[model samples]
Target: SLDLANGPSLEGIAILNIPSIYGGTNLWGDNPSQKKRRKAQKTKKDKDREFSNSSMSSAELAIAVQNVGDSMIEVVGLENIFHVGQVYAGLRASGKRLAQCSQVVIRTRKRV
Candidate 1:
């Protein structure tokens, strides 16, 4: 249940089941040369540093949504307002794209 009349206080909230795009051969295309190029771009230490930094970074909150009406709603972070199928697009605008999002579902939990 939500009350939109008053201002929202969504802090410490959790969103689940958000759809996202995965980078793989299907999307990036299959090319041995590309693979080799990727491999050649980074040294082992560079790879290890990348891995270590990724592990240290905070996990992104996931959002899920279903088409309730006309808009595809998404619950992101602890925000009370939802984006209408624009989360993926927004991410894309920011250089991260979620590929092939057929549909979405979302869940919420409070941080303890």
Candidate 2:
């Protein structure tokens, strides 16, 4: 239970907006149903090095995003509008590579 200032805390399920690379493979993986599960075709040891590189790139981007979000909390409370240049600057400052993190999506959802 969160002791938030706004309102009562409620539980919810959501897939956090974590970026993923879907190269050559089908998106959403092979999840045929909610109960059954299967392995992704491209595992780390698989021959698809391109997919592996892309996965690493995406993982780095996620970390960079997490850093930026933390700074936003400290630097600008409540709201912030960041430009690509600003994001690049932050990523560069943290020594993160953006070579393969090409696709960027932005979505903001806040309740009033």
Candidate 3:
């Protein structure tokens, strides 16, 4: 939460509001690459259905945000809140392209 009313009062907490996030290494299921591979192996009709439902609708995204917000507020206590209309808008304002964004990077070390 980044509500202006409570923003100034909270001393050392940072609030980040994000947009619709997808395409990552999921623990519950296959990652994007694996999904693509499986889709490739599927029949045309299956492929069509997969692509049709691949993207998250606006309503779905809203629900996801609400769910995350509720969990965060409950776990950490609510604070300042800022509402951005959409993820693309926020990224465009900052001149960032989603393709160029990388959330995390892991490096492996060779045996000594």
The model with the greatest lDDT is: 1
- Model 1, poorest ten-residue lDDT window? 56-65
| lDDT over C-alpha atoms for residue 74 of model 1 | 31
Q: Report lDDT (Cα) of residue 22, candidate 2.
A: 22
Give the whole-model CA lDDT for all candidates, comma-separated: 0.28, 0.25, 0.25
lDDT, candidate 2, equals: 0.25
Looking at model 1, residue 17 earns an lDDT score of 34
Candidate 3 lDDT, 2-82, residue by residue in tens = 132322232222222332232321111112354554554453333222111333222222122212343331111122232
Candidate 1 vs candidate 2: the TM-score winner is 1
RMSD values, in order shown? 13.2, 17.2, 17.2
> Which number leads on TM-score?
1
| Candidate 2 TM-score versus the reference | 0.16
Higher-scoring candidate on TM-score, 1 or 3 = 1
lDDT of 1 at 38: 52
1-112 per-residue lDDT for model 1 (tens digits): 2222232443323322333333211211122354554554443223222122222111111111123352433332233224222333343221111211224433336564
